[model samples]
Target: MSLLPHLHRLPSRVILASASPRKRELLSSLLSPLPALVKGINLEIIPSTFAENLSKDGKTAAAYARLTASAKGKEVFDRCCGEKDKAVLVISADTVVESPAGDVLEKPSNKQHATSMMQQLSGEWHAVHTGVCLMLQSSSGNMIETTFSTTTKVRFAQLSPEVIDAYTDTVEPYDKAGGYGIQTAGLGGSLVEEISGCYFNVVGFPIRSFVQALIELLDKVKDKDDS
Candidate 1:
């Protein structure tokens, strides 16, 4: 059975609650092939306002990502779920890099910081953890929320100080988690030697895991409606 048809049955306004262009493009690429099914989906892009300041204290890398993702989803869900007659579904995600030393590396603050982050990653195996959250609000105001995290083990090729310095001089590192994007065409792409898990997760969104979760969530909603 085609999943598109199952997705078409969802009578909800779908929202991508993040401003990351990578994520938006990734999702649009997924749905672009299904014109009929895409038409049926009322999709909107609304960036969440949640401060990504949650501490990773007492939490694993996956848990931290999940927590941040849930907060982002909830922020947008509360703002958009005003219409009682229409169901609303909000999707949000967060990505973080865990260094070999058990440090959670976020986007770098400056070139020096970017250089430092890249240096830490050079010739080292790091974990890229992406957390995804789905917030579903039925027409009756009942809500269902699901959050999960996936980690991709990425190993950086051995880099010299000059190589790291050259890459950090560019504008790519500041906006990306871990001061590097594995999918970037520039030096960033050359940084990674291999990854052991979902490639999309490192890019920002875990589409495969997300589709499974979305289908399962929709099934739950269908069952709830039937009952």
Candidate 2:
């Protein structure tokens, strides 16, 4: 019985392997609602140093996302998993916007590029891919790794030129994929007509899936402890 409940309050600190503020915010929000007992476990923000220059020419959205996340997780784990007394869970993620024409949209170079991306997204559906990797060093000194990806379909609501230009002028689109960020709330909600998948995936991470994986990992750790 104690083992079952122990899954909820992980002793290991959660390490977020991303420099993106949005990812940091979203991952922190997920753990914020845990019981007060687990509050003592800190969330470590460690950005991955892996270069994201992978080629997306022939890869599916999921494959690309998974590759990027896996590399990032491995990079961070190598650095932090060396000499930790408690366990460590490293979470890494990468996102890309897939256009209707089967093209991948990364962050824009400038306002003009963002505006161009917005124009292509006008009144069309695009897929948002988020590759999430979780690697953990258990309390008993066991290392585990897993990776997955989530995709959300997003449709823009026929943006006029003025609207595209206006949104691009803001600093938000410059660092976001497909010239928009759904987590931006006000600005992104206006341009989006519909979304048909995980909302947080469009932001950077997937909440539901991550929680499920974490629970599974915690249960496994508990089992190992009991043995």
Candidate 3:
């Protein structure tokens, strides 16, 4: 079933709680392909300032991703609640890279940090985890929340120190997790020889999993509506 029918019935807008261009572009692309499903649906881009202060501790990588995504979603959802008009649906997500040895890697702080991350990833396998959260409030004030995480395993092609240093100098790794972006047209994609799961997950959002979650979320409320 398509989310359009359900989404169209509600007098609400979809808000994405992120400022990253990649995320905004991806979200727009995801919805654009289904024009009939999302036509006339208001799209709001609201970036959240929620600090990612969640420490590693004993929490697993997926757990951390979900925690951060939930926090971000709630942060934005609360902000939208102040409005008096239509309902709101807020979407949020967080991504991280986990080493074969189980260490979680977030965005590198500096060039040196990115250099270290590349060194650890050279010729090794790492898992990318993305947590996604969807919170929706109907026009009548009914609310629903859904959360999930997806994992993708990526194997790096053996990279030399020179390559890592040169790539870091290009200024792409600092803002991305694991000090690299899987979508880098040349520099980044060349480093990973293969990946095991959803390709989009490594790009910071799991498109396939997200679609399924949305359907299930709407389906639940859909059932209630039918009853």
Off by over 4 Å in 3: 1-11, 34-40, 82-86, 225-227
Top of the candidates by lDDT? 1
**What TM-score does structure 1 among the candidates reach?**
0.93
What is the C-alpha lDDT profile of model 1 across 102-179, one tens digit per residue?
A: 898989999989988988899999999999998776776666788999899999999999898889889999999999
Predicted candidate 2, C-alpha RMSD = 2.9
- With a 3 Å backbone cut-off (N, CA, C), the pairs that clash in candidate 1 are none
Query: C-alpha displacement of 16 in model 3, angstroms?
Result: 0.6
Worst 10 residues of 2 by lDDT: 1-10
Cα-based lDDT for every prediction: 0.85, 0.81, 0.82
Error of 2 at 197 (Å): 1.2
lDDT: the better of candidates 1 and 3: 1
Q: For residues 102-192, what per-residue lDDT tens digits would candidate 2 score against the true structure?
A: 7888899998888888888899999999988987777777666778888999999998988888888888887787778886668977899
Judged by lDDT against the true structure, how good is candidate 2? 0.81
Output the TM-score of candidate 2.
Answer: 0.89
